[model samples]
Target: MTSKDPASPGHRPGADHSKHNHAGHDHSRGDHAGHNHGPSGEKHGPGDGHDHSHANFLGPNTEMIFALASGAALIIGVLIDNFVGAAPGWLPTALFLLAYFFGGFFTLREAIDNLRQKKFEIDTLMLVAAAGAAALGAFAEGALLLFLFSLGHALEHYAMGRAKKAIEALAELAPPTARVRRDGVTSEIPVEELEIGDTVIVRPNERLSADGFVILGNSAINQAPVTGESIPVDKAPVADPALARARPNSVLAESRVFAGTINGSGAIEIEVTRRSTESALAKVVKMVSEAETQKSPTQRFTEKFERIFVPAVLILAFVLLFAFVVIDEPFRDSFYRSMAVLVAASPCALAIATPSAVLSGVARAARGGVLVKGGAPLENLGSLTAIAFDKTGTLTEGKPRITDVVTASGVSEDELLRVTVAVEALSDHPLAQAIVTDGTARLNGAGIPAAGDLKSLTGRGVYATIGGETVWIGKAEMFGTDGIPALGQEMTTAVAQLREAGRTTMVVRQGGRDMGVIGLMDTPREAAKQALLKLKDIGITRMIMISGDNQKVADAIAKDVGLTEAWGDLMPEDKVEAIKKLRANEKVAMVGDGVNDAPAMASATVGIAMGAAGSDVALETADVALMADNLAHLPFAVDLSRKTRSIILQNTILSLGIVAVLVPATIMGMSIGAAVAVHEGSTLIVVFNALRLLALRNRYAESPVAAQA
Candidate 1:
């Protein structure tokens, strides 16, 4: 049997799963005719109760009602004891006991449950304190203590609900019903019923229902909630070589939209690529929920301390009572002092210090589009001394661009470019996209003859039949020095110059002769240099660049980005080895974006995935995921993690220091009312201190160095 007690750590008060319906019918090619089908074929309209604007949660109304009643009873008991001196003694006693029972009942129940489980928590400490006060004939004071304690617990419950509400609020961003078009007819249907390849029409100001690519029309999309990009990104139909090659049937090869992003002024139709449950928004919500369940290092330490502290305090209080009794002190004085000791030493503030800070830190990071998987990662990020980065997609833009095109003696630049474009257009390599893009611009819409019998030579290049001639494009070594005698000293000099400038040189050949050499470079991000400086400013001493590119290209990029070291021509396993070696000396963080980097990232002390908005693997595997492809977030994450760790330490010290000071005072005859006030005040102080983390802003936003031109 599961207990419904909210105070129990295992009890999740508002965790209701009945609202989301996972079993939904496929509406991809269904003929709707006139009716709209909601979940399970239920008829739905705009006015139907499918609105997700408000997410409901079972609030702390019950706890509030009991606290209010207890407060009223305590007031009346105090009034009767002071003002109505002639009143029956039993009247005040009954009123005080009523307040204590009403306010402390839930706490006592949780304490008993915890005791049965062989665990002790704040509830147990609170119960013992209240009981000891009542045993000392301080009924009004004891009742007051219970009322305040219950109020604090209820407020904390409400605060935590608000924190969780931030995640729940993401669900409301997606409408329950989506306007889906199938068989040339459009109808409203449950979002969960959406399937891949189904056309979804999003009107102006409407939230997207699934991850998809635009098939028709144009619009701006606000992705702040999903990617933390404050400005709306313009979307239009344009050719994307990668997507065009990978998804030939994709309606709009240009624009991509994610679920939960709001459509701007224009109405756009998107073909769904992911289901509701698989959307980026859903993953974020799921991750946040799971993150909250994991304990931080400080929280674990506090729990361990409590395990020893609670038992030791109880024994100490009993020892004090026995010692006083053996000294022939009056029973009243002995018991009163012992009760004071129990009230003072209770670790209420210490118990909540770490979790409160961790929750706020996680929520703050989420607002900035950084998803920290759990508290362990958050703590680990703070201590990272060296950071390893994947060059292509992490520091560079990941999109290669043509820098120089050199044609051999007889081959004209135009002829070589036209043949290269025709052949590379059929390929999906990053270099292929660069060639196609540059060639298309130079051709100016002039049609090039289609390449036939195209074949890709992995790691070398591509071959195709263009203009009834066999054409080849790839590495310089593929053509061979013996066969391409025309590619002499001039070609070698040009290739060396381009490679020295950090460009990837590709050799183009046709009919067993060198046609030309094209230079492609995945340039560093505009913000990369500044971001590296910021990382160094924050005490990240070692910055290393790792890449599968040639050593010369890697060294050039590393020099441009101010990195301390660069490792090139390394395979995936080699990258992992490098990360492990770095981890042997100090805490290391690996930043990467592709599948090849996943293993290395996993091996690092903290794995950070850049541009995780599109990759589900990055979202699931990395310890930290930066939604945007920008490197600027790295320093911000590091700074925030450090701040969180510092705050946790500060909170721990403040809580423990208060206990150390108050325990001695209580044993020396501190009043029960004074001990309760100070104890509850310390807990409140710790909570407020944790809340301060929520106000921490991006320190690099306007830094002088970050703003340098």
Candidate 2:
């Protein structure tokens, strides 16, 4: 089915009414200027940037020709040494040095780079080890070491490109233009030119050009491009009663369509709802990038370890060299043996273990439709003791819709519906939309009357004069203590029944008398029940629902989701307290999307926000943000974390395993120092194995095909 907009549709009523003025803009600077320029300054395709970087080469094709010739010479020299057994010393030496120089140049440069950064890198150790091997008359082994290390470096670069491909793919999904309606006529315009209330016509086989609602006509849409679900959704006029009960399908007239999803076969028109930068897809990209930037606790510890590790290795190498020479050993043997020790203990495997796994884990989460902010958050997910979810949007769909209308005090249903819709028409809240939409439909063919002097009481109710009659509509509590007197047992009992069904009950008053009550509910997501059950099976110890909604609504949802504890009617700060209490028992994870929830999000051991069009403040504060609000991915992220941690431990133990056996072998003199050289070199080999995670593909196999396509 079509994907819904990432933002909570009914949470803020007037949010969609804001002006969107990006029409007729020149985005040539952003889109066109990314192309590469050739030597003569002509714009070229992607691969043409190589011209500028290699311009100072000895000549065109010179480097390529030299490389091939040098490689051939080295191959021939090795053959002669293996077969003839008596090549001239200089020939073997020269050929070996040439191969080392060409293949090892980048490694040497990287060594220098690490030195400049005031850190010791594995490159420097490899270089030292290779030099020592050559001095020990092991020319072939030294050359092979350089070649293998270079090969590993190239492979790592390619792996990084693959890891980043998802983001690059997402950036390319949106098309640049849209069809906008102006002055009663449709015209082709850049998406930037879209303005609020401007009807945009989306044709067959095109992406929904902006986040907007249907204003006219009908259509079906393909939302799999963004939602990771492969279903086509049907849309029609809002007046279709049968369609209204069909769970919205995320496919209906005037329903929000995200940026990347495609419009289906039927043609329909939509009103521009939000600016391009504010679209769901845009916010997901932002959140993913931020997550990549924030370092995890493990990453920080890795950095600290590297700083001390390099100096310690240097000291050990010097001490070994001094002890051998003072014992009357030859200076050459002593120095060379010292270098081998330095190479063997460089800690390359340790340095790479954390960040590489973290990078892969984040990418995996994105594939599952979750956007974890950084390595730290992903690591924290596994240790969570409790999870606090915001009730309005997190536990429920967050969009309230009219469920039932009842009349009392002899008021007709038609009269009650008409008055409610008229007053709610002046409001922009989700509850207001639910009431207005349902009221209008029930009125059926009744013409709307002009509403007068409509005044809204923030967070409460509304007062308006419609058809020359003053109407008051809001919660029973809104009627002041002395005004409505205490509630009768019957009224309270009725309200309790409505609340038990997870509905927000608001009383309707007319001419200072109670007419009846209306109930609205933010329906639960279809997949939530199954997803939460899966979480429990996978060892999620506790789940709690938290919301700014009233207590009755929160408890009803908590029961449905199988959460024994629920907290409602909380301000942002109060939610933080609830999270703090959960944390006192064990690690707590707070998940929310409102700016009001930012403080609690930060206070929790891990904060997971809804990144798909969620607020900037919430995205920034949350340790993780779901790029799409697909709850199934939440469990998937947790699974990836456990796997990543296992891989890291394996790499650590393997590296240390080789060291433990080899180090003592050298001290006992059972073998020459050459044996230590072989063992030490194996560490580099083991490190390359751990880096395989960087090349992992389809870790989240069910990720949206469009993310790759």
Candidate 3:
């Protein structure tokens, strides 16, 4: 069960799986020196001034600034040309020239790249249309067209790049150098030079340089960066060095720490176990970077649309420009109409409609501790009709705790616990570990007497000789043996009641007396029930639990959580079959935390991994990952996706509607200036509409489960 709960519950921010405190990532650390988050929500780090990488349809950094400058010049030129009757003709021409230079800067750069590949795309069409407006002696209108076009692209890119920038921010969390301790001498070396088995000294409040095991000191580690856990996990040497160091991947759980997580108070020395490139944070960066390239269906559609539309528009413009052969019109008027029609029909708004929304939605999800890989998953999440959850780690606490303790009439609770804890301490089962923790805390330093001669009853329980008495702890069947005490009617009834309440029970017997029954249960997460309620409230009603636990236990959890259905006693293949059935007609998403759940997750429309921060398998396999352990993020993610989908549709319909109206209006004698205003105005509308997704509401503020938990 602890396998499902890797991070210790006590060290967790809320001390349970319910709190949103983990949203403060050791991973989402924007607090480090030289990192500033701008009003645009872009996190700029040292050495990462601004990325002017390959031209995004929405430009980046300097391109955005240039676009704004061009807008300023165009506005001044328009004022001089129309309002100031006596203004010098050259003044507006010079201003329009500045607008053209600024507006065409990034567009031409990207257009040149496309031309190099012999691809006649949207950028080329935009440039030709603007140049035609200039050719018709409508220089101010052309400047307005280019200025609006550039400004739209720049603003769209700025808003849409939020997710991409958030991902790059992960790389900035790692320190450039690590202080190495070798042969009692310390020196700072580049983090890349740190290797496996090397010792690195981490000072207070400094980010860890590598994933490694604690060797020298104890301190509180703020693991929000790597684990998305808000509470500071205590770091210290393993109780037994010979054991923890010998195990593989000891960096998992206790005794180990990750790179980029901050150390608190005490300085510590660690033996590096993973190279900087292979650390968990690095893997998340690599995986999500790859996800950015996985294009959404809408993006692919537009790409195909561009291939056909760009060529068709160019041909249509040429035919319209020479329409004197068909219509009784002057070439100048015909050419002017053709250029206006071209500007009207440009797909700039359509091009950015989906990408802008997708980008903003993805970034917003990340900020909320949900990593939405790309647009496809984000779009799919909005339409899911059913959600399948793997029960153990995802829906339940995954770590069993002693919930109820019953004592026999003559036996005291302490006495029963003393004998049982002494016998259970010899076992290595997860249940035994949980029992030891409970007993130790309850005992409060008043220790139990030494026990010896332990003997396990196969398929039953264990018994040990403690102070000349045989103490037994296991199921009721372990009793009524030749020398052991029998579970009387009262004791049997108590056991049955505990089982009916969905707890694993064990009978404690001392000598010839039946001590009592102890009940253990892997409780549901604090917010699990509320999250399910929120999901149903949001119209995702067909919630189901598919678990490897027995039918009884699964049904209990399902009932507690208000799930529509429940299935249990499933093998990995059985889970897959269940998800396949659900996916037949419904858009299904499978959420799980284990590798065993991967098959079923793959079979669903979307795979969401719960508590994916430390699980590499979860990160590699899921379309969306809830970085924090809180179940509240699940509903938040679904709500966000739905909002994003709505925004995308709104932008799409508006884009097409503008083009549809403008195409005919321009041919019907709409001026070039009017077409440019309407066309670019629609483009800006879409960009700003998509940016609304960036301001996500607090999902848990109204959640009763979240509040109570």
Candidate 4:
């Protein structure tokens, strides 16, 4: 048997395809000659001659090269001193000088710059230690100190580069050129040159070059790179009123595709909705860059400690040299001990401890399609005790579906459904779509009567004229309230029963009579229950569901997802108030996916946006953005943050503990060479420890609760 194509309309048994003509599109005939397309269908070849040259002449590899050269020179100098004592002293001196200049030149320059700025950095301490070592006639030890210190710098630079490259890789995902169709003719053009509303054609297995909605064709899109979703999502034109209304650029919500996502083996045409620079991928790149610049709590503390510690070390070195001279100790020996003190007390390891871990954590999160705005949010995630979630899109799928239908005694189900569909077709609300979808499916190829004079009743529902009859489809109160047709006891009881079952119920009226009551529910997301359990396992004490949805629906979803509490029928301001109340007790994080939740999210200690891959509002407002719509990555983020925090603490203590042990050893006549080894060794250890966070992964996979549910 041939493998079934899930993207095809007929893949599901009993799916209605009469309205969609899938046979006419030829996916295999869209290949254009002389155009190189990547696996994701993004057109290859440089377009617009965009220059990517950077001004830093040293490049990312310069430090490593200098470090290797200095190390080799230091080794050669030591060999000469040990085995060729008869050789001229100048020979060993020249080699040592070469090593010092090559390895210590940058460090000295940075120290001088810091001095000019009235800042005492770890570089300053290293320079002072090396200078004193040289002055004390300990050229070999001084050269060794510079070489080891430079090697540490090189390794730190390399570690930071790896993290930076992870974010930079996003820029390479979008192709430079795109194939645009204008006036029915397709031609290759620079992606930057494509304007809004321009139609772009993407062939099979190509990456989308721009964010847009598909006006035609059907396909499956692999959005793993942008959203961290493992499963490929099916793409087709679907009438979603909420998406259309919220994102005006997206004409058919289901047909929307983002730049950098790989298209399946089906050709589709998309109308460009956003410019190349404004694409979701570009926003991610920008956000990641910004996040790297924001300092974490630990980083700030380290900086503050360095500001005081560096100066204190300098004063202590000076005092030691003065006291030794006053006691009639040899000036050279006194200087030697003072230099050792500088090396032992330098805060290089302490300074790097926090930033390295924070950067690694941020990079690791980015690779998994989660963006932590900066070190602050990354650090904050570890401290969050309670998390508030918006129900519609955070805990639930946000897509309403008709689940139950109750018709009046004389009215047939088909007649009730037909009248409902005809009126709901005029509405753009999520519930309206559910009614129309179920109604149309049950119609079985039967044509829906035209709806006329459609009027929306704000939040209540819709009013329309269908086949010359005044039909109303909305909340039960809309029909029974003052000056409107009152619903009978039978229909009211039916609506009440549906509501008690946690379904959003609406009454259908035709010609001023109650025809039926329809029940619609936005089901909980597949991963919601498992994600909640995982959050609890990760030490999240309080989980609350906050939503504008009715109380029963909110409570039902809260129970389904294992939340500790549920707050319902809240306005945007009410959500903010609820967050304030939660924050009064403990650190609270708010997770949501809409503009309405922005205030509440901002009010919480940390704001997390779900399904951020497509929404600019989520990208801009939330502190942390879970690129995908599901909560699979939420637990991972929390675990990673806690790990990062723990690692920073470990590094800080180890670094300080080394200085505490080594400084006293230096004063007690320990060799400067050993002091240098201990000091530089601690720096390396801290860096390598921080690097461990880069490899951290979720220890537990998402539970199978979602599948069971």
Tell me the spans in candidate 3 whose CA falls farther than 4 Å from its real position: 1-106, 134-144, 154-163, 213-238, 248-256, 265-271, 301-315, 479-486, 560-564, 701-709
For 1-709, candidate 4 gives per-residue lDDT tens digits of 0111212432221111232111211111110111111111111111101111121246435556677888899899889989998898798889988988888866776566456655555566677778877877678888888888777666655555455455556656776678998988889987768888788889999989988887778999987677766667799954553465357543533677888888998899887878877788777766775675577887777666766666777788888887664777777877888888888887667766776677678777876778898889999999999999998878887779888889998998888888888888888787888888877998887767888899988878788897788888788878766467788899989988999989889988888678989888888888899889989999999999998988888888888888999999999999999999999989999999847799999999999998787788989999999987789889988998999999989998998899899888998888767887788788778877877877776554343221111
In model 2, what is the error at residue 331, expressed in angstroms? 3.7
Query: Each model's RMSD to truth, in Å?
Result: 9.5, 9.9, 8.9, 11.7
C-alpha TM-scores of all predictions = 0.84, 0.72, 0.81, 0.84
Which residue pairs of candidate 2 clash? Answer: 13-428, 13-429, 22-192, 22-193, 23-192, 23-193, 214-254, 291-373, 373-624
Quote the positional error of residue 60 for candidate 3 in Å.
8.7
Over 148-229, each residue of candidate 1 has an lDDT whose tens digit, in order, gives: 8777655555554454445455545666778999999999987767888788999999988888787688899877677766
Q: Which tens-of-lDDT digit does each residue in 328-387 have in candidate 3?
A: 988988888888787788777776677667766776676555777878999899999999
Q: Find the candidate with the highest lDDT and give its number.
A: 4
- Summed backbone clashes in each candidate are 0, 9, 6, 5
Indicate the TM-score of model 4: 0.84
The total number of steric clashes, by the backbone 3 Å criterion, in model 4 comes to 5
Off by over 4 Å in 1: 1-59, 86-89, 237-254, 326-328, 406-430, 443-474, 478-482, 507-516, 700-709
Worst 10 residues of 3 by lDDT: 30-39
